[model samples]
Target: MSRWIVVLAALLTFSSAGAQTLKVRHDHDPWGKCVGELSFSENGIVFSSEKEEHNWSWGWTDIQTVDRRSESEFSILSYADQKFLLGRDRPFDFTVLEGRGMDDTILGLIQSHLPRPVVDRLPEEVERVDYEVNVKHLHTFGGCEGVLRFGPDVVVYDTSHAKDARTWRMGSAIVGVWSVGKFDLELEVYEREGGDLLRTRRFRFQLKEPLDPDFYYHLRRKLVPVR
Candidate 1:
């Protein structure tokens, strides 16, 4: 009947496929923090804590989305509301304390399980791209520099601004894509912004090289098919 008992019971069901585990620091507030192990498995994600009250388990269906704000930091947003936070959904923010932060392999695994868009800022160490071009990602004021790499089923924007960089799976994260001039393009993705679910975010890019018709047409056809 205890809360931790339920959490442990759920954890036991996981047939951990080596159960990718990460050492994480979950800071509850300025003065309080819980150091724990976050394990991603076939069942769901579970946080094991020494402080029993802080322990929790979430199934894939209960997750709203996952945000990889940066390589070392990420948050798992869930549908459950926190009574203390004025009924807003509480996000489990974690900072990786060990190993190579999050890589594409981990993100790929997580995205495959949850039918939700994930924000990935880390770039792959090695990738074979169908097309790649130097581009400037436009912001409200100035912008950041990055390379826009398009693969068969992926679109990656890797930038010097690590926080600005993003890797989006074409079919899952991307909603649509468009281009205006031969040098400007935009990509739309599903995101929860300002507490809005599935609210789309557009990233506009100014291509350093002319947007080749071959690449643009292929990407556009994939984003928006002919009726």
Candidate 2:
């Protein structure tokens, strides 16, 4: 029948839209954790957990914000209040256990679907770059050496320090990027401070090589939204 055909088409659409599912683990407080499946689709995000109480199915409208800093880890900020935390927003943290850990592709998909901006830390995977400079990312006490790369849509710091190497997708991750001189560059971005609050995180880089002004202008231009 014609009605049956329409119904089948709708079903297929729903299924295909949610095809990118990942094996994930949900971590609870001090020492507790659970295995589950986390999926991001056109409809929303779904968590099929072994325990029923831990299960979640949130539409985009239900989310407060989302943070994806590491390739393997991400957090979903929800409006659900935590009584123990004085009615604060509850957060769901997930870690990719299988398949490609929330790479640039997945991050892009999420960014497109979400109505609001997500704190995206996963940098764009670029093969060719416009410029690269040897620099030291400064910390309170010390710093680490890395190659700061400027690509078409992303800026990345490739360092030897584990968990220190970061990629920032231009326009989204970066609040502002400016140069103090040929030997110094500063980048401003949003980072999760405590629970789900996005606070400003500034990365100061001391460049060993001179940064080209022309390259900086070209790269900074991309931050301006196109009409």
Candidate 3:
């Protein structure tokens, strides 16, 4: 009927014939390791490390980050702080049928399921952009290198290795914004205590490139309306 319907049908057919169960070595930190079967389906990712006794499954929403550790290895960090390593040798076999490497394929699937940056959900009239910045959390003094994406109503900070990430909704979690210099900006956000804003914490970030002279000014302007 419609062009959109044709596109949707193609996608459905492709997905139904795509790769599913993959046998690889599975590693569970501090729990030992075993050869297991990993599968990707509509119900998220499921894995069976040892028969039916040691199997686990996680929905796409349960995953927090996926970091490529090396050319041949990657790690999945779940929201519960559990880490799973997959690769060709360290933990899993990368080789699959037709001499294809499954690492990249699996990675693509995971990335597609990750939450979009705040700017992505902005109204069409709002201008938004993404930038890489060096960041430091003031409370823990932790060095968190990541990209910052901002718009009129929201800001999302995501670490390079996906070690830490947060989406701050202006007026709800953002408390203050300060310009350190042409290249740096500081964001003060509310620290949550049992799902409630209990205190304020600061994070400092310096833009990776200082080409935009009015970057900080524009960011401040965006925050004002939302705050």
Candidate 4:
């Protein structure tokens, strides 16, 4: 009987160990009036948001946290990037919409609006990069678009209204290697007639670590200024 009891105890201990759970975290945007959260586990990664008077949710599967250090320090590798670093404790420009939760929505909307072939030709890693859209007429749905490159090839274009223009305006072609963090992107807004260059504006921001559940609960209660 003593021998049987010992074997059963060992099995129970092993089963409990396999049931452990993982946590995730994220940064809050005060200016934008939104909250972004990230969670992770042995299963996969999930992203959620409660802001702008509406709740939005999205996620990515087949995600594994190959490396973990502390609450604010870790690295993740996914299907796209072989290596990605996460700094949860460290705070960056959390207010910037480019790196916020709406990224997926904007990408989806733009892809839906533009030609499918153009989006298909884009590099697979393009989705991993950060971007910003400056809207002039929100109702009209027109503004400037810019993409920041982590490897190479940065592109910026404009979708502005024109008096006699048949098509949308193509902003000045700014081509250069952009750093990983946030940057001031200068794109020229042009008119349809003679392709007249209108003006250039600099958009500023910084790139922080990716969102995770462990970090989200940590900062969700705290308040950070948007601007």
- TM-score, cand. 4 vs. native: 0.19
- TM-score to true structure, per model: 0.84, 0.80, 0.44, 0.19
lDDT, candidate 3, 92-177, per-residue tens: 21223232234545545654555421111111222464444445433354465666766566577766544346656664557678
Q: What shift in Å separates residue 22 of candidate 3 from its native position after superposition?
A: 5.6
Give the C-alpha miss distance for residue 127 in model 1, angstroms. 2.4
In terms of lDDT, model 2 sits at 0.79
Whichever of 3 and 4 has more TM-score, that candidate is 3
Task: Predict model 3's lDDT versus the native.
Answer: 0.53
TM-score: model 1 vs. ground truth: 0.84
User: Best candidate per TM-score, number?
Assistant: 1
Give the clash count for each candidate: 0, 0, 0, 18
Q: Write model 2 residue lDDT over 126-180, tens digit each, in one string.
A: 6888888899999888998988888877788888774457777676768887887
Candidate 1 local Cα displacement, residue 11, angstroms: 20
Measured by lDDT, the strongest candidate is 1
- Order of candidate numbers by TM-score, starting with the best: 1, 2, 3, 4
Those runs of model 1 whose alpha carbons end farther than 4 Å from true positions after fitting are 1-18, 29-31, 194-198
**What lDDT score goes with residue 113 in model 1?**
91
Cα RMSD for predicted model 2: 3.9
- Candidate 1 or 4, higher TM-score? 1
Clashing pairs in 1: none
